[model samples]
Target chain A: MRIIDVHTHPVFMRRGLQRTEIDWLVAHGRALGIERMVTLGDVLLHGRFPTGEQISAINDVTAQVQSWYPDYFVSFCFLNPTLGERHVMSEVERCVTKYGFKGLKLEICNNASDACMKPVMEAARRWNLVVLQHSWSMTNIKQRSFHTDPADTALLARRHPDVKIIMAHLTGCGVRGVLEAKGLPNLYIDTSGGLPDEGLIEYAVEHLGVDHVLYGSDLPGRAATVAIQRVVGARLTPAERKKILYDNSARLLQLN
Target chain B: MLCDVNAFLGSWPFSIVPEYSAPQLADYLAQSGIRRAVVSHLGAVFQPDPMLANRKLLAAVRRTPALAPLPIVNPLLANWREQLTELGANAAVRAVRILPNYHNYALKSRRLDPFMDALAEAKLKLVLTARLEDERHRYFALRVKGVPCKAIAAFLARFPDHHILCTGVPLFDIQNLAEKHANFSSDLSYAENITMMEMLRDKIAPSRLMFGTFAPLVSARAQAAKLTQSPLTAQERKLIYAENARRFFSL
Candidate 1:
C-alpha cells in the first residue's frame, strides 16, 4: 500500500545532508512503501529556543531536502512561537511564500495554549496550512512551560476551531493523549516518537476516528519501516491501515 | 529462525496489550517470522515472590516448545537460591531476567554478587532488563525508571566472568558498554534510529547485538522490521536475528 509520513525530520543535526545519506534514506523509505514524507525541519537544531535566524536556517535545510526530491518531500516551516507575533509572522511568511511549505511545525517553543501562539495560529489560518504541534504527556517531562502537552494541543484546537492541528507523538502522548484528541475534528495525532508501544494506534483510531490518525516517524530518532509496521501490525482492518499510512496524510496535505 | 530475547506472555496492566497464552504468543511471534523466543511472565515483575509466576510460566509454555521460559529472579528475595534450584529443575530455562527498578533493588547491590555466583553455578544465563516501558510514556502513577548505565557499567566490571545479555537497553548504552566491556550483549528493543543497523555497525559488533521485541507491550512485527528491513548484511542480520541469541542462550 502507498504511504505518506506526515511527520519527519529528514536532515537531523546535519545528518542526511550528503547526497549518499539522502539517497539511502529515500531508498529505505521507498522500500517500506513510503511514497511521500512531510519534513518537519530540524526544529531542535537550535535547541528549545532558537534565534530567528537559526529557525530560518533550520527551515532552509528542509527546503534543500525538498528540492533534492520535490515529488517525495513536503516541507513544513518550523517556528519558535515564543518569538512574538512579528518574528512568528515573518518566519511563517518567508517559509510559506518562498518554499511553498504546506504546514507550520511547532516544537518545544511555548505551550500550545499560550497567548504567543495567537500569531502562529493566525499565520496558519492565513496560509491555509496545517499546524503540527509537538505534544507529549508532560506528566513527567515537567517542561510544560515551553513544551506542548496533549491537553494543551487539545486546547489549541478548541481555541482555533478553524485551523487544522495535528498533535505529534501518539506513543509519548499515550492513552490520555488519544482521549484529549477525541471529539475534536480539527485535532489529529501522528504515530511518532519513542518506542512503538502496542495498542496505541488502535486506541487512537477507536477514540479519534481513523481519519484523524496519521503515520509519522520522528526520523533519525525513530525508523520509518518500524513505524509503518506498527500500523500494519495493529488489529485494524486493511482500510484503516491504508487510511493511516496514506489517505489521511494525502488528504491533510492535499497530496494528490 | 528469529529468536526474540524479549517476549512476554502476560499483560502489562497499564496498557491494552493482549495477555498472551503460550500458544497465542507462539502464533504472535510466528506472524513476524519468529520461530523461537525467550519468554517471561509479567506476573513475576509485579508479584511479591517471582517463583510463583516463574513456575506458572514454566507450566504455561510447556506445550509450546517454540517459547523458552526465562523466569524473573528477584535477587533481593530471601529464597533466591531456592528459586534457582526450582528453575534449574526444568533444565530448559537457559536464562532468568531481572528487573532491578521494578523489584526495588539496585543493580549495584552486593546481593547480586552471591546471586551471580549462584547463577554461574547453575549454568543459567543472566538477562538484565534495563526497562520495560519508556519512562516518558509510562503510566502517570508508575514512577519506576530504567536501570542506570553507571550501575550497569559497575555491575559489568564486578562480574567480568559472567556473560550477561542485557535486554531493553538503548543503542547508545550498548555502544558505551561495548567500549569498555566485552561480556555483555544487548537486545535491540529500545535502540531505534533511521538506518539503525548502519548506525550500530560503527559502535558494536554483529555478535554483541541481538534481536528482541518487547511484544504484547510493543509490536513484534515492528521490532523485527528494525533488523529485517535495515542496511544490515545477511551475515549481520543472521547474527542479530537468531544466531547470537542461540549461542547466548545455548538454544
Candidate 2:
C-alpha cells in the first residue's frame, strides 16, 4: 500500500543530517511502502525556548533534507509560538518561500490555548498551510503551561476554524483526545506517539471518522513499519485503512 | 514460531479493550502469528488475593495449549508461598510474573529475596514487569509508576544467578541494565524507535532479547511487527522470536 507518514522528525538530535543518513532513511521508509514523509524539523534542538537564530538553524537543516529528496520528502516549518508574532511570521515566510514547507509544525514552546498562538495561526491561515501541533493528554505530564494538551489543541482549532490543525500523537491523546476532536472538521489527529495500543485506532476512526484521522509514526523516535501496521491491523475495512494510510493524508496535504 | 512473553488475559478497567476468553485470545494472537504466549491475569494486578485471579487464569487456559500461564504472585502477601506452590506444580506454568509497582513493593525489597529463592528451588522462571502501560496515558486515578531501573539493577545484582525476563522495560533502561548486568533479559513490548531491534542488538545480546506483545492492552500485530518488520538477521530473528523464549522458559 502507498503510505504517507504525516508526522516524522528525520533530523533529530543532530543526526540524519548527512546525505548518506538521509539516503538510508528514505530507502528504509520506501522499503516499508512510505511514498512521502512529512519532516518536522528538530523542534527541540535548542530546547523548549529556542532563540530566533536557533529556529532558523533547525529549519535550515530541514530545508536541506527537503533539498536532497524533494520528491520523497515534505517539510514543515517548526515554530515556537511563544517567540511572538515577529519571529513566527518571518520564519513561516522564510520556510515557505525558500524551502516550500507545506505546513507549520508547533512543538511544546507554548500551550495551544495561549494568546501567542493567534499570530502563529494567522501565519498558517495567510499562507494556506496546514498546522501540525504537538499534543498529548496533559493530565499526567502536568506541563500544560507549555505542553499542548489535546483539549488545548481542540480549543486552538475552535478559535481558528479556517486553518487546518493536525493534533499529533493519537496514543498520547488517548480516547479523550479523539472525543475532543469530534465534530471539528478543522482538527485532525495523527496516529503517532507512545505504543500502538490495541483498539485505539479503531476508536479514533469510530469517533473522529477515518478522513479526519491521519497516519503518523513520530519516526526516528518511532517505527514507520509498526505505525503502518497499527492502522493496517485495525478492524477497519480495506477502504478505511487506505484512507488513513495514504488517501486521507495525501488529500489533506494535496500530495496527489 | 513466535512466543509472546507479555500478553494478558483479563480486561483492563481503564480502557475498552476486549475481555477475551482463552480460546478467543488464542485465536486473536494466532492471527498475529504468535504460536504461543505467556499470559498473566489482569485481575491479579488489583485483587487483594491473586490466587482467585490465578485460578481463573488456570481454568480459562486449561484446555488451550497455545497459552502458557504465568500466574502473578504478590510477594507482599503472606500466602505467596502457597500461590507459588500451586502455580509451580502445574506443568503448564513456566514462569510467574510479578507487578512490583502495582503490588506496592520496591524491587530492592528484602521480601523478593526469599521469593526469588523459592522460584529457584521450584525451577520456575521469573518475569518482572517494569510497566503494564505508558505512565503518561494511564487513568488519572491509577498513579502506579514503572519499576525503577535502579531498583531493577539492585535486584539483578542481589540475585546474579537468576536469569530474569523483564517485560515492558523501556529501551534506555534495557541498554543501561544490559551494559552492567548479564543475568537479565527483556521483551520488546515497550522498546520502540525507527531502529528498535537494530539499536537493541547494538546494546543487548540478541539472545537476551525476546518477543513480547503486551497484548490485549497493546496490538499483538504491531508489537510483533516491531520484530518481524525490522532489519534483523535470521539468527537474531530466530533467537528473539522463539529460541530465546524456549530456552528461557524451558518450554
Candidate 3:
C-alpha cells in the first residue's frame, strides 16, 4: 500500500542530516512502503526554545533533505513562535519563499495558546501552509508552560478557523486527545510516537473521523514498520485505512 | 506458529480495549498467527484478592486447548498457598504470573522469597509481568509504575536457580537486566526501537527473547507484524515464535 507520513523529525538531533544518513532513511522508509515523508526538521536541535537563527538552521536542514530527494521529501519550516511576530514572520517568509516549505512545524517553544502564536498562525494563514503542532495529553507530562496539549492545539484550531492543524502523536495523546480534536474540521491527529498500542488508531478514526487522521512515524525515534502496521491492523474499512495511511496526508499537504 | 506469553482474559477498567473470553481471545490470537498462548486474567490487577480472578481464569480457560491457563498468584496475599495448590492441580498449567506493580509490593520484598520457593516446589515456572499497560496513557488517576530493573535484578540474584520470564519490560531495561543476570528471559511486547532486534542481539542471546503480543490491550496484529516483517534469520525467528516459549513453559 502507498503511504505518506505527515509527522516525522527527519533531522532529529544530529542524525539524518548527512547524505548517507538521509539515504538510509529514504531507503528504509521506502522498504516499508512509504512513498513520501514530510520532514519536520530537528525541532529539538537547540532545545525547546530556539532563536530565529536556530530556527533558520533547522529549516535549512529540512530544505536540504527535501532538495536531496525532492520527490520523496516534503519540508516543513520549524518555528519557535515565542520569538514574537517579526522573527516568526521573517523565518516563515524566508523558508516558504526559499525552500518552498509546505507547512510550519511547532514544537514546545511555548504553549499553542500563547498570544505570541497569533503572528505564527497569521503567517500560516497568509502563506496557505499547514501547521503541525507537537501535542500530547498533558495529564502526565505536565509541562503545559511551554508544551502544547491536545486541548491547546484544539484551541488554536478553534481560534484560527482558516489554517489547518495536525496534532502529532496519537498514542501520546491517547483517547482523551482524540476527543479533544473531535468535531474540529481543521484539526488532525497523527499516528506517531510511543509503542503501537492496540485499538487507539481505530478509536481515533471512530471519534475524529477518517479525514482528520494522518499517518506519522516519528522516525529515528520510532520505526516505520511498527507505526504503519498500527494503522494497517486497525479495525477500519479499507478506505478509512487508506485515508489515514496516504490520502489524508496527501490532501492536507496538497501532495498532488 | 506463534505462542503469546502475555495474553489476558478479563476487563481492564481503565482501558477501552474490549475484554475477551477464552474462546474469543483464542480466535483473536489465531488470526494473528498465534496458535497457542499462556493466558492470565486482568481482574487480578485491581482486586484486593487475586485468587478470585485466578479462579475465574482457571474456569475460563478450562476447555480452550489453545489457551493455556497461567494463573495470577499474589504472594503478598494470605491465601497464596491455596492459590498455588489449586493451580498446581491443573495439569494444563505449567506456570504462574505475578504483577508486583499492581499488588502494591516490590520485587525485593521478603514475601517473594517464599513465593519463589513455592513455585520451585510446585515445579511451575514464574512469569513476572513488570507492567501491564503503558503508565503514561493509563487512567488519569492510576499512578502505578513498573517494578524497577534493579529490584528485579536483586530478586534474580536472591534466587539464582529460577529462570523467571519478565514480561512488559522496555527494550533498554531488558538489555540492562540481561547484562547482569543470566537467569531471566524477556517478552517483546513492550520492546521497540528502530533497530530493535539488532540492538538486543549485542546484550542478550536470541534465545532469551520470546514473542509476546500483550493482546487485547495492545494490538496482536501490530505486535506480531514486527516479528513477521523483521529481518531476523529463520533460526532466530523459530526461537522467538514458538521454540523458546515451548522450552520455557515446558509445553
**Top-TM-score structure, candidate number:** 2
lDDT of 3 by residue, A1-256 (tens): 9999987777762344688878877888899889999999888878877878888888888898899999999999989888889998999999999889999989899999999899999999999999999988888767999998889999999999889999999988988889999899999999998878878888888888889999998876777787887888789999998989999989988888
Alpha carbon lDDT of each predicted model? 0.89, 0.91, 0.88
Q: How would you encode candidate 2's per-residue C-alpha lDDT over B101-212 as one tens digit per residue?
A: 9999888788888899999999988999999999997899899998999999999999999999998899889999999999989999999988777677768899999999
A1-256: candidate 2 lDDT, tens digit per residue = 9999999999872254788888999998899999999999888878899989999999999999999999999999999888799999999999999889999999998899999999999999999999999999999888999998899999999999999999999999999999999999999999999999889999999999889999999988888888888888999999999999899999889998
Clashing pairs in 2: none
TM-score of each candidate?
0.98, 0.99, 0.96
Reference-based lDDT, residue B211, model 2: 94
Stretches off by above 4 angstroms in model 1 are A13-16
Compose the digit string of candidate 1's lDDT tens values, residues A1-256.
8999988888862354777778877987888889999999888777899999999899888999999999999999999888889998999899888889999999997899999999999999999999999999999888999888899999999999999999999999999999989999899899998898888899999999999999998887888889989999999999999999999989988999
Candidate number with the higher TM-score (1 or 3): 1
Each model's Cα RMSD: 1.2, 1.0, 1.8
**CA error at residue A196 for candidate 3, angstroms:** 2.5
lDDT of 2 at A123: 96
Candidate 1 lDDT, B1-251, residue by residue in tens = 68899999887888787688899989988999999999999999999999888889999998888989999999998998999999988878888999999999998888888999899999999999999979986878899999988889999999999988898888788879888888888999999988667677888889898889998789999988888777778889789989999998888
Please tell me what DockQ candidate 2 reaches.
Answer: 0.80
Off by over 4 Å in 3: A13-16
